[model samples]
Target: MNKLLSYISLSAIVLLTAGCSDDEPKSEHKGLTGYVIEANYEKKALLVAESDKTAKVGNYDAEWYSLNDDAILHDSKNNTVLLTDIEVGSEVETWSTSRSFESYPSKTDLSKLVVADDVKHPDSPMLQKKAIQAALSHAKSISDTAAILIVQNVTTSKSEWIIQVFNSYSEKSYEFTVNAVTGEVKQIK
Candidate 1:
């Protein structure tokens, strides 16, 4: 009888071990989802921490990314700002695709950054001031742009301006064009 009992106990132990091991390996092979690693903003882009998966715009989520590398970001006006200072090996939430990763700030908040002038341009304060003065030099031009504040994007082609403005004349938002560069604002009739 004792021998039979020992045999039963051994079988139970083997079964438990086998079950646990099988579950463990399965989990190991599973992929991680929606994981965000911290990244830094640099050179007008985001430098993700540690891994090469620099910050970028994901099709799913949008959030602020911190910079870890010495890399910095520059605005169109040439304003420079420190992107990251996270300690080595430490990572923060970053945006990356399963296949590829990027290290540039998504053009999400560009409108907020746009102003009469950029004070953060890399040029000297005096020079930056001068540039701002020039950017605002076209007072009427700026006002014209402001009137169509719902513009989606601004594209310049040589001496011509191709402005993408949001047309709200209807219930849905539609994109329209204008010539901002020439100081001649044309709208779709």
Candidate 2:
């Protein structure tokens, strides 16, 4: 009986191990969009953080990406550009696929970084100061007391504005999508 149990356990382990093999075909890989926190111009690499509320956006979940020397840089309109043109605070959407392993912060091969320009500052404190004002005006339920959180992950590989409004009195939070280029309110939640 002991021998039989050992055999079954071993078989189970083997099957499980085989199931998790990287040899298995994977689905289509996806791109990651986020702002650059640090750019190692010396190493020709970039430390990109995942863009999301759960992600630190600009600060955390930083992954070191090896940029191909031949990699092309693009402008907001997807025009081919130079490497030196890219800036640290700029947002990027990578075309390369992510690695399979469960590495720290995860890593990916960078094909290119998507750089989109923000034309409107209505939601921005410095550029528009009107961003919050626009958000408040757009959101009927959100009052002056509500706090606004801006996240730029409204779409893929592009930097769009997300106006998140939180009201302590009502104990509710609202999210709104604003066009980074147009400064228009796209959606309200």
Candidate 3:
């Protein structure tokens, strides 16, 4: 009886497979294909849709707002794509096109960005890199990184070089004073 049941199940699976459509189009898209290059959350739309026609990320014509709400779709090479499911740092391969790098943070115009009132620019790139590395290192060690920001360089009367750290990402802005010369972190606010 068991042998008979196994044969019957196998036959059912074979029938199901044979009944499936094999000539259906590979992608769900009917028009415009590209890998999602960039999504602009602020704009409520995609910033760039990467297609073979454009090498660099550029504005391209894609189907937008087809459904009940304003939605975006793209065809990289020739296949339809969705941007939300894509990981921020992962390569994506679609039937049409292939993405070499992962998605990155959006670009901002320096002139428009609201810098902190107390932000101090370092004298040189070397000092800036050093200060940033020190601040990142200190934040990493504290295990409370979500509450930190790399602020301007601070100099005390005792000649101790310090860097200001802010926790603006959290509920309240907390500040930490890091010794720039010695990489010492001191909780200030």
How good is model 3 by TM-score?
0.27
lDDT of 2 by residue, 1-189 (tens): 999999999999999999889997534344556655456777777655554544553333446666765566788787986666665545667765446345644566676677767434443432222344445456544455543232234332144556554332444556766555566775466
Cα lDDT listed for each candidate: 0.30, 0.56, 0.35
User: How many clashes does each candidate structure show, in the order listed?
Assistant: 23, 4, 9
Best by TM-score: 2
Q: Identify the runs in model 3 with alpha carbons over 4 angstroms from their true place.
A: 1-105, 108-128, 143-156
Q: Mind giving the per-residue lDDT tens digits that candidate 1 earns over 1-189?
A: 999999999999999899878455211111112112223344333222121133232222223332223323343455653334222112223322222224221222111111123223232222222222222233224343322112223334434344332222221222223232324444432
Best by the lDDT measure: 2
Candidate 1 has its poorest 10 consecutive residues by lDDT at 26-35
| Residue 162, candidate 1: alpha-carbon lDDT | 40
Q: How many backbone clashes does candidate 2 have?
A: 4
| Cα lDDT, model 3, residue 173 | 30
Q: Which ten residues in a row have the lowest lDDT in candidate 3?
A: 108-117
Candidates ranked by lDDT, best first?
Answer: 2, 3, 1
Better of 1 and 2 by lDDT: 2
**Between the candidate structures 2 and 3, which one is better when assessed by TM-score?**
2
